[model samples]
Target: MLIKGFLDALQPEPILSVSQWADQNRLLDSKSSAMPGKYRTSITPFLKEIMDHLGEYSPVEEVIVMKGAQLGVTEAGINWIGYTIDVSPCPMLFVEPTKEVVELVSKTRIQPMLESSPSLAHKVKPPKSRDSGNTLTKKEFPGGILRLAGANSAAGLRNMPVKRLMLDEVDAYPVDLDTEGNPIDLAKKRTSTFAKRKIFILSTPVTKGLSVIEPLFESTDQRYFFLPCPHCGALQHLKWENLKYQYNKSSKVAKEVYYQCEHCQEGIQESEKTKMLESGVWIPTKPENQNKKRVGYHINSLYSPLGWKSWEDLAIEYEEAIGDVPKMKTFYNTSLGLTYEESGDKPQWEALYDRREDYPRGKIPTDEIAFLTAGVDIQKDRIELEIVGWCEGKVSYSIDYRVLMGFVAGDGSAQVWQKLDAVLNETWIRPDGTQMSIRMMCVDSGNWSSEVYAFCGRYPPSRVVPIKGRDNQITIISAPKAVNVTRKNKSVDGVKVWHVGVSLLKSELYGWLRVNPGDPGYCHFPMYDEAYFKGLTSEELITTKNKNGHTVQRWVKKFTRNEPLDIRNYARAAAHMVGMDSFSPKHWELMRNKRTGAVKNKVKKKSDFWN
Candidate 1:
């Protein structure tokens, strides 16, 4: 009690805005900070009001910043830290998405802030000092402790009591930390100890309805940073829809992109950004914001500091992101400060089953079929495999799906694998008596990897590949990487492990399943049985709310057995191995003629009576 009284007495009586404090003491280090000079609010003048209102004297209890990248959002938070530490000393908790981020901010932002500011540097001594209170994740000051914790660690957010809470990149945080409920709510519990506590939630909005920041923004008075029009002087928020650009041939635009005036329809030159930004004002759209305890602000990349990322830069990024939904979604979230919504079109198993063609299983390839690839799924009791046919436009047909029953011996020899070997090279007769073999086969190396490697090694490298699944958003099938194995002629005969992004492939497969049979990239199945369809559609793509209030898609199996899906993915991966993705019509024509040409030549000649 005495310590609290003494600390309160020691605190500077005069109120100082975070922006003002930053201008006076914040020095941008050339090594780490983007701007290497004394901090100036004039640069990101739009954020100054936010910083000032967040000061100790302000009535605001929470500030939510839903902003685009490079708009000084992080800098604003840093400024608040500077204010809380230097002006009004108090215990603070800074939460990032992960421990890595906590360490990152500590190294890049917090450390630099202390080293650069003389006032802060004096109080928070360098690590070299004997009594140095500063560490990697925690900083100790005279009257307050700045604890840096990751949202991933529930204990970090729950145990500590703090007057100020800063949650950075809240959208990146998981929905639950170690299953202790929402990290935001857990962190909020710590602030109840201090009546004058301040909470700052800042993030680039992620998925619509799934985003953490958007709901908070809606609950508050949604304020937009309004800039005066250079021509008409009409106040307006910068929106992406108002921006205009022209695309030239080659699908790449070298032309300029500019923001058009909504009031006067005039082209607002990028040069006018400074004058406009200086005159910018945040106008709250909701009436509840007048209460002053909670405030929300949203900004976009268009308002990025002059000479930084320009409208033209954003235009180029948009051009590059064409046809790529994820890339484009990232741009919208980070640059436009918007949420992306998935199509929510989940394909039904019965629908796919109903669409199965009359193509007889393992009999003949249709005219649509070009080449065949195989995928092998290893199990303790049986080996399941699928032969998939590929043609122009990524059209796929399931040629055969079978289960070879046998157990692998300790010596790596298995009757199932022998059965696999027979079928792996066996020819499938096309409609015109043409012969086709599995061009490339990818065997799952996840289970019994040693045997899989040994089995794959038995075949030609080009014909057989060991595959494993990867958890990544971008790649469907990555290039071969090293696996756990030892072999002679390691350079030439080493077992290659292909990494397949199962989630990405599943997403694509489901999307294709939604497509009509005649459509491009449509997937076709033979009338094998109901179980096959069940395996194909065993997994459902579930979109759940992440910690950041953003929606992320994950494949959750409805049933235990998803071998059909796994083997299909493997066949698709094998198809990639045989250059199915970018295969030209000419290439397909040559491949289509290969088997028929061989059959024609054999039929034209008579077989010898004696071998």
Candidate 2:
């Protein structure tokens, strides 16, 4: 026994790549994985090369993968961690978007993976009551410690040096952590100390100009998996355009689905996918960068394993997402692993003016109008307001645009404010003879904020609300912040002020403006003059470098007057705050019933008139 032990110690450590190591020892816990058994690279053969590059023997410094959801990339990342702990035994760090997510992943995924694998379980002990090193966020093994951190926390990213760094869902990470800088840059600094370090970056990219992963992926060789056609043997990467399906027109369900080969024009069935995936090869689009230290791979849900996310499923999802911006964005980001490109260029004002519908300006044109909202823009000399009618599917109609020409400063502000109140309180009739009043009003407080707050505070908080525009906000409207209002230079009662993400709303509005009528998120206009169209399209989205030397998108005015755009943004915010964003079909039906019921009550029958 002593001789055998000595011989084992003398024998060189077995050389195994990350894939080989995972296939030999990694076990997927039943609690975490759908397929809870031994890990097999064959199941997701496309990931075998990606994992092998992360092995301890590889000289590649960085491996970046821009991928869609449920492509087994996360499991592949866990496999690398397992191999590092058992074989390489070096300090490693895993950064997630938030600390809460890190904790959740640690308890749900990392802990289960370690506890289920015998080789890993023997090395990394489970967290104990007294063991600080072996906890949810930190795991200690023979020669290395695994630290899980959040990209939002700068301290967590900078506190330690790590030989291997893995950033999962990097696009979800905060742009700047505690104002220190970009989280990716901060985390990358942690691996600079190691001579031969491995860095893995993975994410489903969010947007084209703003995505962190897309740019990183572009910097590498940009490898894509190419599979040979089952019939023609011609090799090509899968594309959404080549995917064809036959669906029932009435039911909108897929009847038949197949991938049309680019070369042979033959339809490949789903059954042939497994063999094709197994025989696939990764070819770099930019072959000159093949020798570069950083390598990148991009794969969409089209290549998702046989049992997961079939082509038929994607076809049906794409059909359902048509004409809807948010759903289509999800289909592009989460399914195709592609950035949803938003056209930032200025939409044509002439086209919008020419296409104005021949409808009355003051009344709702259609019974589809669910509710009404008003956006008030305060200027030094005048107040501009637009009454907008909103319906399901984010279809909006411009009901009225009024320019209250009165001194909106000091004592004269009261006249314009009172005029705005009169307009807001006014009832507009729909074509069905049902009356509708402004459900919500968002008044701009950026200019003459105190006066705006005082004016908005006059009404109930539900009706009129003050809003401030923020360029950096992620959502269109966040929770309102209470602010103390001042009257006569003395503090009055506090009022709720909502922060509007103007940039996001503007992007949405621009996209909506480009869409034709009858499409989801389409914007309809009355017979307004050319000036209104010009004001609506006054600003152009431009990409410029910030003071921090990072590229940032900004909306710059091409014309002097942009109150139309600002007012529309506020109206969008008001709709969001009123829960229109989450309103169900039942809510819309209830609103319609209320409007129709009120109309019915106004009319008296011939028998009731005598009584």
Candidate 3:
């Protein structure tokens, strides 16, 4: 009588279709059958609707379900398995990520559902006796056997021709399996021969990038369900961002916040939302028979009767404890199958994309380019130089490579300086017989400052620039004031070279240079060097302030180390060429007019001051 009453209440009205009526009936009673001499286990309306769909045995070859946690998705799967076993009795395989999870499911969830479900309990025979150590598989009256396998082991999934395959938490499966291959691919092979085979892939969404489960969800044959709004009568999907809340300060309580209708722009409270959802219907949005074997459903925690209190209570607790970001996002979007708008750290890869189109290998164009800069990354025994030649606003060519065996001590310091001098002189000459000197050659003065200084002194004045790398900002230290030394009837040349900070150069480059996608001019000597990029925190960079209370910006290095070669060299070279120095024409003229050769040693005198 109880089962009959529930069934009669569940029957569709004349105007409603079978699926529509089933949805209504399941929502009202929440139970389908009653068992004699056993405690009645109430079914959730959501699970009952799924069970009803299974009973129909539609031609749908697959069912995809997106569900909130603790909505008994696993339980529904088990019940469906039991139903299939009792009605049809075919080979079935249940695949999970690990053996431990399989064991837990088999012992706890599966066993209890079979024991408690009155419909399943009455149909299956009692357990048979076997050896104490080894347990025999339990068989219900129907001859179907349900086997459990772990995806982690390749040997476990071999040679299994199954009619139904239930893949739980497919997203969490390891990308590669020991011997069988990817767990998903291996499991699909098990059902290759069976034309009427049923496969169900279900999981909570993870990262947005493509993964194994994404292919199934992307298929057009799959179904996506949307609930209609009561006030505006618009079909809509639930999103975490739209949720609003009202708080009571004295009681420290929070209630379900209202959301403005996307269509009507009117506030819809939880009560109105419930009414609208109750009247809403879920139907197949795809065409009649294009990849028609698949079905997908996204379930939220709000749909579960028992889950309501927890959801409401958590919203209140989270608002008070840690703020709304995690609780609202994780619980609503991940735990529940709701959409969320993400706002946080932007990927550095996006910046890299802007220069992508400008980096293709092609013939170097001969034109009057405005800026020619070289960034040198220095090492103890070797140095790398990236020469960027820009024509108009586009990058013409970038030569990124290293020069080895330039060690100062190994090859006498003079010899090393001589080689660098040769390279610089070569860069200044144009292929068409004109002198195309680089506006700036940023030499790295980080580790070997003395050697760099020695080399700078030998070059023409105003030609070589000194650069310092600190934090993110590169500051060029200005040339010291030239002091007159006329004592003891002797004259000495003071240090007159300009010192440019790399941070200053980096600022200019970031501001003026537009690195389009594939820009060759945006070159790093050591490509994708993490040491220059990952050290500093974003918050530290953003919150940094100068002495005058303005935001102080610095370029993040692409590599890690006390002295980053690529960034340091690039900054120094660019700064020197951009004329970011205070120097007179006489300085360059005086140094250029001097004879170029190795310096000769002279006897020391009291008046020979090392100024």
RMSD of each: 9.2, 7.0, 22.3
User: Which one is best on lDDT?
Assistant: 2
lDDT value for candidate 2? 0.84
Tens digit per residue, CA lDDT, model 3, 1-611: 99999999998754332233322322111132232232212424444444444433556667777666666566567666666554556777888877877887766655555555555555554444342111122333455567777788776677658777888977557655774457877888888898788777777643233133444555534344455777667876655445567778547677756666677767666655445555555555555534546666766654444324344554564454232232334454455554332232323533533333343222123333334556555577766555555442233344333354567543354555556555565433333333454455666666665555444444444455444454321123443334233433545334243444443333333323334434423332223334333321121112244443323343443434423334443644463455423223444344333333322222122321222
lDDT per residue for candidate 1 within 278-376, as digits (tens), equals 999989999755667888888889899877888888887776654434456668888898876544345677877777889788865576577788889
Model 2 CA deviation exceeding 4 Å by range: 1-9, 24-31, 115-128, 134-137, 174-180, 247-250, 354-361, 374-385, 402-427, 437-504, 516-520, 527-531, 547-549, 573-611
lDDT of every predicted structure (CA atoms): 0.79, 0.84, 0.50
Which candidate has the highest TM-score of all? 2
Clashing residue pairs in candidate 2 are none
Give a tens-digit lDDT track for model 2, residues 502-596: 87678788889988777878999999988888889899877777666766667899988898999998998888877876676789777766753
After superposing all C-alphas onto the true structure, candidate 2 shows an RMSD in angstroms of 7.0
Q: Which stretches of candidate 3 lie over 4 Å from their true place?
A: 1-56, 122-128, 131-141, 232-234, 247-252, 272-277, 284-290, 306-329, 338-611
Assess candidate 3 and give its lDDT.
Answer: 0.50
Question: Which residue pairs of candidate 1 clash?
Answer: 171-548, 174-547, 175-547, 210-549, 210-550, 211-549, 212-548, 212-549
